[model samples]
Target: MKFGTMFTDILASFFKKNSTQLYPFEKNPTPERFRGNLYYDPAKCTGCCLCVKDCPSKAIELVTIDRAAKRFVLKYHMDRCVYCGQCALNCRFKCMGMSNKDWEHAALNKEEFLVYYGKEEDVREMLENISKPPAESEHK
Candidate 1:
């Protein structure tokens, strides 16, 4: 209301400790169970689809290239993920978890939100299949 009152308040705030964290410049430790980016381990995955089924957001999809060879690709839609950790909780093989460190997912492109977790060759194959037109894929 008064200039004197406002001046004292501003001075007090200047002397007081900062209550905000300096993110991007100064990093703070995340909690033990902090859920961030979605990660999938292809080696431990068995193509059971339990994680896929339990996800309420329908963010994860498991694609099986060869069930006999234990080859599978995990399509993780980061944008759709609710970060509820249901997929991690439902994975019996310990193939899925949320990364606390690599959680900075801010991006300008939508394609960056879609992540594929699997062997390099398998991911490439899956990407190729997705890029192909429906008519061409039907013939192959």
Candidate 2:
């Protein structure tokens, strides 16, 4: 319409008080069924490859144990994940779930996105055994 009329309207609105939410002072609560993140249960996971197979985005990877071993190695790519919940839905173990904690999944490399599932002690012991510490010196 008229340039002068629009200009005056804009100026008036600029000085007027806002009647909306004060985001800085308020924290909105998440819903009960909010799908936030993905959770993987290593104990229930049978290495069935169901999650890996059904994932449309190919974000989930089924890293099985060594040829001789009968275990699994998880490598879930959170960065590429679309949170479709398809994998979690069809999982026989019911091992997966949408996490409520929403954290920014930022990483510089693809390897950083990989997630491993296992017991705390098992993982710690595995790392310790896999990566031995420096031997004691016998200097005279």
Candidate 3:
């Protein structure tokens, strides 16, 4: 009886369509509202930290490069992200949102997860400022 059941199951499987997808070559379509990864637009950003404050995983970090100039850098850690879409909802400037097109975020190293979003000049200035000591007047 056991041998007959096993043989019948194998015969049935041969007539059925393949359930597994040929990933990497033939990809499956993602849903319309699928929250794949966070995307940041520096031009649309108002330097507001609402996204950072609302993130449940604390994956978003806003670094103020210049208060007067309203320059900021958005540090988005993909590894720590929960993809809840709260950040996009909380952002009043409409700078942050999720992109459904590119969801492949696999990384071999932890350092690859860290994404800095900002203007070229702003990022350069921020890096330069970080390397220098605070001025005496600013320290006061």
Candidate 4:
């Protein structure tokens, strides 16, 4: 290449604006179809377990509190989810879906990734059962 041509190119490049975004301070808007954090509505759930079956990653678990009473607890394993939106798509009652607003699931402990969605009393009871010692916990 000619010296004059190379010099001109360098001059033009120096005037170009930086093409970088200030992340952490500036958050880009999530797109309309963005598959993010998984959410569940226990009130809308019908204990069908359709969402659990459709999940390819097995990230979600449906715990039946009382099938006849329509009481259930959804255990969402965030770390295992692939954000494919499959569970939401297969749900006919609109009980499960991904939320664009709450996509941030950063955590240092693996336990934080396991989220429980259900009634206050039911969730408390389930948690108590899980925390019990192996000998005290029921086998079934």
Candidate 5:
């Protein structure tokens, strides 16, 4: 009985196609509306902070660059993000969305998970300004 079962299994294997996919060589098509990674467009963003507020995981951080000028630096912590798509849905300006292209978020360092979405100059200036000591007048 065992010999007969083994022979049947061997015959079936010859007719059936391999179920495994060659992942590195052959990529599978991502489904429509696939929530993979967060994408932000600074040009479309209005500095409303709606997306930040709506995020359930508290992964979104809005750093104020120039409040009077309505400038902001949007910080997205991929490590903390739950990928719930709530931030994109809450965005009134349609600046934030999920992209299927950047699903791979593997990194050796924790800092690598932090993604900033804003003007390059603004981000640099904000970092510099934060590092500086406050004026004596402000302390007084």
Candidate 6:
């Protein structure tokens, strides 16, 4: 090969070898359109259990705790979830939205995979919003 051709090849090889991801050391931000996680709006959810009933994968479950308080604990099995968007679509509360927060959901214990949003303060905003009249629920 010519000297110029050899030099170009060497540079290309060097650059290719150096191209690597620094993952743990450097975190990357997700794009706005990126679908990472399914976040429940707590306020929009009426505990109708539509999502749980319609979920094909059976990954979602709504458990009633305080009947008089209109309280429900929604549990999601990350392992069984296929990210199909069906659960969000079937949701009557309009409380479910896709977020761009992608963190590893793996754990040695199977119970750890189940996520819940049951805190009183955490659901306060959502509950108040859901309790409002239809006309009052216009703007988010």
CA RMSD per model (angstroms): 2.7, 7.2, 3.4, 3.7, 2.8, 12.3
Candidate 5: pairs in clash: none
Q: What lDDT score goes with residue 120 in model 6? A: 68
lDDT of 6 by residue, 38-137 (tens): 7776545678788888878998877666545656667778778877777787776688766777645657898887777666653565557568877855
Candidate number with greatest TM-score:
1
Worst 10 residues of 4 by lDDT: 131-140
Q: Rank all candidate structures by their TM-score, best first, as comma-separated numbers.
A: 1, 5, 4, 3, 6, 2
Which wins on TM-score, candidate 5 or candidate 6?
A: 5
Top candidate when judged by lDDT against the true structure: 1
lDDT of each: 0.89, 0.73, 0.85, 0.88, 0.85, 0.72
TM-score of each candidate structure, all chains considered together: 0.85, 0.60, 0.78, 0.79, 0.80, 0.65
lDDT of 3 at 62: 89
- Candidate 5 TM-score, true structure as reference: 0.80
Q: Global lDDT for candidate 3?
A: 0.85
**Tens-digit per-residue lDDT, 78-136, candidate 1:** 99999999899888899889988778879999999988899999989988998987774
Regions of candidate 6 where Cα sits further than 4 Å from its true position: 1-17, 120-140
Model 4 over residues 30-101: C-alpha lDDT tens digits?
A: 998798998888988888888888888999998888878778889999999999999999999988878988
- Please list the residue runs of candidate 2 whose C-alpha ends up more than 4 Å from where it truly belongs after superposition: 1-26, 66-70, 106-111, 120-140
Which portions of model 3 show Cα errors greater than 4 Å? 1-15, 67-70, 131-140
Q: Give the alpha carbon lDDT tens digit for every residue of 41-105 in model 5.
A: 77776777888888889999988777677577888899999999999988888888899878977
The residue pairs that clash in candidate 2, if any, are 37-99
Instruction: Please write out the lDDT profile of model 3 over residues 59-114, one tens digit for every residue.
Output: 98988877567677888899999899999988888887898887897788999998
